[model samples]
Target: MQEDSPLTEATSDSRGASLLTSREPSPSDHSGRGTSRRSKITRKSHRKSRAGCVNCKSRRIKCDEGKPSCANCKRRQVRCEYPANPATSAAASGLVDPREPGDLPISEIELTYHWATTTCHSFSAWPAGVARVQALTEEVAMKNQHVLHLIFAFTALHLAVCRPKRKEHYTTTADYHYERALALVTPEIASLSPDNCDAVLQSVQMICFVSWARGPQAGEYLAFGKHGRSDWLVMFRGIRTTLASLSRDHFSKTHGPNTRGKGRLLPPSDGPFEYEKQLMELKEHIEFVSEPADRDDNVNSVEVLQEMYSNRYGGKDGEYHVAFGWLYRMSEDFLDRLQRCDPLPLIIYAHFVVLMHDLEKFWYMKGWTHHVMSGIYEALPIEHKAYISWPMARVGWIAP
Candidate 1:
């Protein structure tokens, strides 16, 4: 048999939809379960007409009205999304009008164009190597269909955040590309090769960006909630695992298996830190508010924060993933307390949210800091609320 390219396009599926969370495959799950549900995607039959998918009309482009994907979107290198009950919606909404297509302020082509130039840089936190990562991502994406689709997907998501009135349209567009890429890429994750390693690793990050940029999940904030670690963390943990699977000749060496579990001091910084004082105050309040049994656990949690907060990342503008180092190193017991909405952990997590706010300038991190901070404030008791004054005031979080 001749060799098959990894760039094979995904066929439209008639099978029932599944949640993205449920579809994420664990490394130990060699069953290839993620691809099983997608097995029923039969060939799609297109109904040609003047009208096309929702994205075409939204972008004011001339769509050829193909099912699953249109000629215009495919040619422009952007996501394709057909309306549900496409014929019915097209007929009812009168989406098609007889006129020449016009240019847009931010066209779909522009969105795709930004991916290599702008979106890819967000993956690397270090300023010195952003261009290198972006170049690698684009180079890999060109030969890999899965990586290309996710690149476009993330760009569409960024565009959605930029335009709130058209948020739903762009978000749906992003999901369409993301779902397709994920379906095709899931099985290949376990059996990575030299050729596909970088592409697959890049796709994993695209998955994280798509998940996080969608805004806060209802119950999940910063990977802690009633159900332990959120799905986001579940997916993100793969970055290191995948790196371990590969040689790491080029990928940034930041995410290697973190054995920094506990009892290690961070690289010391020279100066009086405000966060150190905040931690001291937090420890003081834990004495006042915690029950005898709970007090010890709460103190353990703060001590973990003390280690995380004791240093600065490259002096002020923190590294990209610096904020999340605490979450990765936190004990399972403390995570349980967070899931239970324990006041002390919530307050401590709020301080971490301040670090998360350091990345607030990024489009994905823009509103997340305030959102997580608000969740903490709401979860905290009135007495403990005072401890988060700095975080609350820092993020300008207003109570509902």
Candidate 2:
């Protein structure tokens, strides 16, 4: 129970005054003001939590007793956990001991709840698509431990972005599950078949999402990693090689794809022409380069981007694939240059992500445009940085 604030204050001050006077305070002590005022005060009784979290109790605050993260701890951006209830201890006998801040005990249910309710809806832009993806993710994750881990990984990473105060906590959890998913998925990838295809494909998508969502470091631009390695690219080639052995049925779609192609192209003041103009100027910039091999590698990359825009992609199609599908279509040479931080390809990529405005609106793709574009703009030299101004403006980035 909370102490009576006014009474406690008056009694303490009166005793201190008495000690200074070498006697106890009387009715006239301290000008006789606090005793009468304190006597008029009445303490209110309020209910307290019976099972508050340890974090809340230590801080002498109230707790809503939210699982996984209590309201107070979530607000404070710290870990929230309750002391085991003696009454429920037997029921929790099977729960794993949480090894670290990220490793939550008996959290499969909590994280899965988050996955089914919130994170699952992030993949698809439309309602029907959302329902379909949600069903598929739940159905597939049920029979696969790795898929479940992937779901939890994706959910935790999303939480990290949404709750910045708990970033380290959720990031660590995301990283733990991401690694767990890789360990379990590796064996199945070696022997991919129709039976495991659905699970494997879902896992693949989650992995890619998590990687991209986590942002790229200086040594890692786009799919490239440290020492100029095609990190995510190589990972895909392996999965692609294995998937090629399967049939068209393994990769069936609920709906045929839609493309806001060049046929829907608008005028000079509108998007298609203006967007293509940036890409066209990109190719022209590479064309003026002194090195033939350098010009060819970068120009072909820009051409691939231009062609993708002109042919199958340009407008808002409400399809997430339309944004990054070119990654699969891009040449290995171009991808290598991207990994190496080539100024031309880097600038081209900045333009490419302008197509990602729709994607950024997606829950998973949220903040990706800002995160990636900021990196690209920083990586470019001052002279080459001018190349990305259109994209910078498009994404609302003002370069410093």
Model 1: per-residue Cα lDDT over 230-339, one tens digit each: 77776776776787776766444432233222222323443335667777888898878888877887777777667655444335323446556677666667777787
Estimate, for each residue in 1-400, the C-alpha lDDT of model 2 and write its tens digit.
Answer: 0122111122244322111111111111011112223466755434255567766786787766665666877775554556654324433342433233453334444565566567767776455566656665555665676877777788888887788887887876677677768989998988888778767877876777776667644555455555665455565554455556777476545311221222222222234457766777777877896277777767777777776666434443444555566676677777777777777778778878776654666666666677678778777788888788888888887866
* C-alpha lDDT values of all predictions: 0.62, 0.62
Give the residue spans of candidate 1 off by over 4 A.
Answer: 1-111, 123-127, 163-168, 190-200, 226-229, 240-273, 284-304, 313-318
Pairs with backbone N, CA or C atoms under 3 Å apart (clashes), candidate 1: 13-41
Q: What are the clash counts of all predictions, listed in order? A: 1, 0
> How does each model score on TM-score?
0.62, 0.62
Candidate 2: segments with Cα more than 4 A from true spot = 1-106, 162-169, 215-218, 230-239, 245-273, 288-300, 307-316, 381-383
Worst lDDT run of 10 residues, candidate 2, spans 22-31
Tell how far residue 319 is off in model 2, in angstroms.
1.3
Q: Which ten residues in a row have the lowest lDDT in candidate 1?
A: 21-30
